[model samples]
Target: MPGLTFEKLLLIAIIAVFVLGPEKLPHYAAQLARLVKSLKNMASGAKDRLRDEMGPEFNDVDWQKLDPRQYDPRRIIREALLDDEGAAAPVAVKPPTRSRPVESAAQKRLGLAEAGAAAPFDSEAT
Candidate 1:
């Protein structure tokens, strides 16, 4: 079904005719059809057996949710980390407070001002 298009199937048929010859082609084709039919019947029979063993619960089962391919690692981790209620509570934060300004090393070396005092301006430096 995936890769067997009409063109590819036609090519295969042509090749088979050349290899197997016209005389034996019909016999082989009938055998192949029978094999495919038997395989389908086996698969359906297995499904029916499983359904009988499972009883009415088989129809109630969520097939899509149970599928392994639908699972996501990130979502599983997130769910595991969450509370039983599912929603996360909001956190409270404190407002920032103003602090004293820092003094520069030049101001300390010049000895022009105290450690926390503002520096005096020099007109030439500008």
Candidate 2:
């Protein structure tokens, strides 16, 4: 029912008319109808076969109960953050990193300040 529309039927008819010509178009159209019917019957048969194979377990499936669009990221993140904050155990707090010692002007001027020290001033006189 979903796929059966007037436009689609018209398109199929046009294609059939083109490929089968006006003379044999009726025969080919009949064959096409029979093929479509057989396909539908095969699909229905497969569904019934699958249900039978699944046995009594098939009845337990609640297809309408699942709604995949219910996920909420904000709620999940809020709950996780709250849970971490509310934990009873005292978490080890990392000590504030010792502030990097400021280099004196003398040390900065001299290249011997540190092994990886960058030359602060550009000196083109080599």
Candidate 3:
């Protein structure tokens, strides 16, 4: 990384220009690019060969599901909590219980006895 600074880069360009000359500098640069590409391919191939020799144990990787960019801490926490508490129960689709309709005065009186629940309605009957 340090070797690829602007000054080093300029120096390399100047040297390449001087050594290869202006006429052939472009050609040599293209050759250098091709060499770098081939070297990269060779290095990667070597890594694969090493892994192959090391057997399936070395290459026992799950590459499909792995990607650093997809990491999500909140999702992980939610999943862990759900698992810890056993699989989450299915959400109830029903509406919340509403106030029960008062039938007779006796039922209304009984409901009122329960306290703070249902207040007695002052209807014509009352």
Candidate 4:
């Protein structure tokens, strides 16, 4: 984009003037103007065709809501496939429960802990 600045465009024009002398420069400039105008017309035609095909509903749809960042990951993917009516059930994340008393592996190997006793890690071993 920076290359399209006024200074760069002037540099390009100077180069083109040298390459295609004064007599041909004007002709090529006119051709370039026509090319740019035709490209803009083509883009407008495509947009008009889309509007015709989709009708009024095209403008009514909420494009921002359909964007993925607006919804939870699971709900968005599920919604795309029409797999559910209600929002996806919230996923619960927690550590696995340990019912018995806990001890470090080093404590058991060295016979340093009694049964059913929670022990801090061995400082030296750690």
Measured by TM-score, the strongest candidate is: 1
- Which ranges in model 3 have alpha carbons more than 4 Å from their true place? 59-126
lDDT (Cα, tens digit) per residue for candidate 2, span 15-119: 878887999988877887999999999999998998999998888988765565555789878788778965786589996675676567778768546755766
Each prediction's TM-score versus the true structure: 0.52, 0.42, 0.40, 0.47
Per-residue lDDT of candidate 1, residues 1-119 (tens digit):
67789999899999999999999999999999999999999999999999999999999998988999889999898877784576668578886564744556787687844645656
Candidate 2: residue 108 lDDT (0-100):
70
Candidate 4 local lDDT, 19-120, one digit each (tens): 999999999999999999999999999989988999998899888878876779787687776766675677798976887657678888877568755556
lDDT agreement of model 3 with the native: 0.78
Q: Candidate 3, 2: how far from true, in Å? A: 5.3
By descending TM-score, how would the candidates be arranged? 1, 4, 2, 3
TM-score of 3: 0.40
- Clashing pairs for predicted structure model 3, backbone only: none
Which candidate gets the maximum lDDT versus the true structure?
1
Q: Which stretches of candidate 4 lie over 4 Å from their true place?
A: 1-3, 61-126
TM-score head-to-head 1 vs 2, winner: 1
Off by over 4 Å in 1: 67-126
